[model samples]
Target: MSNLPPQHASEGLSLADQVAHELREDIIGGRLLSGMALVEADLVNRYNASRNTVREALHQLGREGLATYVRNKGVMVRRLGVAEVRDLFLVRRTLEIQAILGSKPLREYQSDRMLDAIEAAELARDREDWQAFGTHSLRFHQHIVGLLRSPLLDAFFTNIAAQMRLVFAVAPDEENFQRPWLERDHEIHDLLAAGHRQAAAEGMNRYLDDSEHALLDLLSHPTRA
Candidate 1:
């Protein structure tokens, strides 16, 4: 399969929406790095769309808080700061743990998604693809949010995931940065799958706490991180 995201192929989306959606996916997928310039000319060529369409697309991203306009610098992927990391985790804990705690007794399909993410991470680890491992780990949490069955929160979490990836990228030691939590992802999934949701919720809270602390530490010292 091609590594490129689909361009202008989905039904019912307008030209500008096509570009915005693709860029949004690129951001969440980490193909577009935080603070990377979103040049109008380059985007026009890349998406095979008009310059106006690209501008509109970028406007949409800016509205979504995934990108921002800077003085003399034009638009770029939004660079999250230390404070944003803290707030992101606060939301993560709220939505993620609540999903686990709120979903009474749990269900196979929900747990299945978490299990699939775990297996994907293991595959990435076996291949020594640390970046893919990080992506899969995020997928695990995305599945956790899925247990809530709220489309609105699911959509909001997509933007949060993009910001979260930017925070993770700040840590140069990516393997050591993400490895500890990979185990936790598996552990929580096991607890949820086995219907031990209270245990799973507790583990999730601690996991987010530790994860947030580590991220803030990384942001504070990116060079050494």
Candidate 2:
């Protein structure tokens, strides 16, 4: 993986936010494996941040569902069990389906952004940049949710998508897992562009269903990295 850009105090972000952003990227990029311990002392040493900053960053990750604070275990990158995986996908399916079915007609700008996101993902895939591919893939879906123009829903989906990355990090054959979805993403976008709202919603439903099964299958019979 490439080196993370250095965080500067002059950047206007809080120290905690900077720390959290770096650690979050590590988790999503699979640099920090699931269930790996996140020790405050270790983090402080690594980031050269204060203990309070590390603590706050860890709390932020907890809120994003990227980490969990166990009673005596402190913080660890969350490892979702089979049931939790299914439950997360269940809520994801519901939210995405609602967004697709109830969203306003696609504004031209929204369409353009969606297409850009897909194209970016394709480019990333061509370069075997799985991290960028995953990032843009989420952005593509985020643009679909953006159709609702609801800030609350956008924030909610963003949080869920972060958790989804945990699952993506653990899946075997990450390239194969992400490849098929590129076509489905294109099909969904095409349906929306054609003004076939119901068809697009149905297409999203199928896409989510297939994704849920694939992830669940991986959880059931995981391949160790």
Candidate 3:
């Protein structure tokens, strides 16, 4: 228990949702490793939340497939098997390819969001803010999906983005590792804005392929991780 003051658990969002977000982010960001038991009493004390809130939060995480409830081991962060990582990336490729294809001609408002997200990503990179970059990069792509004007697609892509980030958290040298993706993503955005949707989609496909390959390779050989 570090001496950092606990945040008021009831400050804003519903207690359960707030706790869920905190725990989810930590698990996905690698602050909490896979298979680490989530002791509810410890969390209640750490976040100054009630036990019920902690349990509700754990349940939420389990629903997201970020945690598991064991018969005697309590809640623990999930460990993605190699096959699962590949399946996840395959899902990402399909969804993102569709998002780019459907986005068609990019609008000014959507471009603005993309640029803002890119700038935020660059700033986060400069400051070594991997967490922020991971989050904002997802937002950048979500904005692209939003431009397609399909709420269903937006929701689908959001879930895909979350899972990708969770997979990314387990990789080693993530800061340097993600640079290639960032570069390709930047180029893809430019192409999309310049009315080259096909080219942008192509670039996105290649990016997804490389990302999936790298992540799968890492997971297969944790000794190199």
Candidate 4:
């Protein structure tokens, strides 16, 4: 692979840190799919980094549960199983529902962030850019969890989103799989914005149930996807 332009390192981030952050975003953004080999040599060339930097980046992904070391295969994207999917959904429900129903007052900036994600997803869908649509859709939920104002939960959910996108990679039809959630996200946002917390919570519950069921079904029957 030809070497690409150097990463624009964030302030205070080392080259290795920048490489790892970019790789993490690729996973969360659906550019890297589950079970795909993360070849060190190619990555070193692609990111314009040394072998050590590339190895460190891959190790970061491994620590984040997004990559793994295979004896002969080196490192590859971690292939998730059904049990992890179920457990992820459980955590999704717990955190998202509390964010909606908890006594903490809703913040305007948080609401605007969610709206921005929804509008971005809508734009992506309009352009038939399903991959970008999926990223924004995931961001919508991440912002929902952000409403709680806890940095720890926000960070945890970022990892969850990355892992969840790996599962999303297996969907046979991206448009068909992701279109409904866009509408549901909008509806829930509307309810919450109008101060209808109970209704929003109910809509969120339904959304989570439907989403978890669909994903579990897809994982259980890969042939269907």
Candidate 5:
């Protein structure tokens, strides 16, 4: 593989952004694994970046709850404890159900956008693209909430998405696990667009329940890094 200096890695991306994006991908894709130690000098040599830049990048990840920095021991990729997993799903359930129930009658165009997000998610899943799948999956749900037209709901869902990213890191075969949801999500969007608000809400609830169950099942076997 060709090695490029981190400072010149990509155009239009700051050094800190480049470092953060690279490390974030490693964390989310399970390449770095949970609780893996993040050494500054090692990363600095690996990315050919300055220590200051690496620290700034790690700070960003830390803020997202993707990593934790400890004095003397340095930083490590954050893993979701069992309780953390339960809390994440609980919060997600509350936000999503509210979004669905509060959504106004969906118009045709609005429904189309929702369908588009589902299709994107499905395609990403088929390609085993975990990063794309996670992002598109969040978009699918966020679009459902967007129908509600509430800024508070929007912000809540956004934070939920970030937390879900950590969960995705622990899930086995995340793409395969998300496939069914993608199909069901498309149907839910169709139902809402058809103005079947009650049915849409019901479908959303079932989706959340099943998703939470699956994630919990996966978490039952937390492997060491």
Candidate 6:
């Protein structure tokens, strides 16, 4: 069982949301493996939350594709198949490329966030903090998507980012899985900073293609976690 950080009863977030947040962290952090059953009773005990809260949290996770409910089997952490992985990358590539192509000339705030993400990622890599590196990498792409100022798009990417974490968790070598992308992320940032919008978009497309290939390769060959 995962030990969640304590939340005060008076905290502003709803009980369900609080439970969901903790569960999401466990799922992303790999404490809860893919396809593991999420028993409502277990969660209620683990979180000291009401049955209703646990149920609602499961529903929210289902909505995010982090968990799925089967009529007879109840809920379990989601397992992505090869086709799902392919489709995810397809949608991600399209959305990201559009964000890149549509990005305006370097607004200082946006550029700073992008550059900060890159720098943080480098630091995380140096420390061999794969989880932090992954977070920063997602932040880097998120800032790119943020350029469009579309809340809807931003939310979509956020959901995809969560799913991507599950993929990374099952990958063979965490460090190797994430290592190559650090430089690629910097390249994309540099291209955009230099005001080469088209070039940046193209670079993003190639980056996504390479990422998809690597992820698919890992998915096709399961490694014992």
Candidate that would win on lDDT: 4
Candidate 4 residues 127-169, lDDT tens each?
9988899999999999988888898898789889999999887
lDDT of each: 0.83, 0.81, 0.74, 0.86, 0.73, 0.82
Q: With candidate 6 superimposed using the best TM-score fit, by how many Å does residue 164's alpha carbon deviate from the native? A: 0.8
The C-alpha stretches of model 6 lying farther than 4 A from their native spots are 1-14, 25-33, 36-42, 45-48, 70-74, 223-225
Q: How many pairs of residues collide in model 2?
A: 0
* lDDT score for candidate 6 against the true structure: 0.82
lDDT digits (tens) for residues 91-110 of candidate 5: 77677677767777777777
- Summarize candidate 2's per-residue lDDT along 1-225 as a digit string, tens digits: 223366545666787887887887675445776778999988878888889988998999888778998888988989877787888878877777787788777789989999999999999999998877887888898888788788888867776766787788767778878888888999999998888989998999888889988888888788833
Clashes of each: 0, 0, 0, 0, 0, 0
Model 2 reaches what TM-score against the true structure?
Answer: 0.82
Clashing pairs in 1: none
lDDT of 6 by residue, 1-225 (tens): 445455634556687877887877665455676778999998888888889989998999998889997778989889887887887888888888888898888788888999899999899999999877887888898888898899888867877777777777667677888888989998998898899999999999999898888888787777732
User: Looking at candidate 2, what is the lDDT of residue 132?
Assistant: 73
TM-score of each: 0.91, 0.82, 0.79, 0.89, 0.70, 0.83
* Candidate 3 runs further than 4 Å off: 1-15, 25-33, 45-49, 70-73, 150-156
User: Taking the tens digit of each residue's C-alpha lDDT, what string does model 3 give over 1-225?
Assistant: 322224644445577877776775564444776677999999999878889988988898788777888778978877777787778767766666777787757778888888898888899899988777777777776776676688777756654565666677766777766655567668988998998878888988888788778878887776564
> For every candidate structure, what is the RMSD over all alpha carbons to the true structure, in angstroms?
2.4, 3.7, 4.3, 2.8, 5.4, 3.7
Runs in model 5 lying further than 4 Å from the true structure: 1-64, 70-73, 223-225
Measured by TM-score, how close is model 4 to the native structure? 0.89
Task: Please identify model 2 stretches exceeding 4 Å from their true place.
Answer: 1-22, 25-32, 45-49, 70-74
Q: State how far residue 2 of model 3 sits from its true place (Å).
A: 16
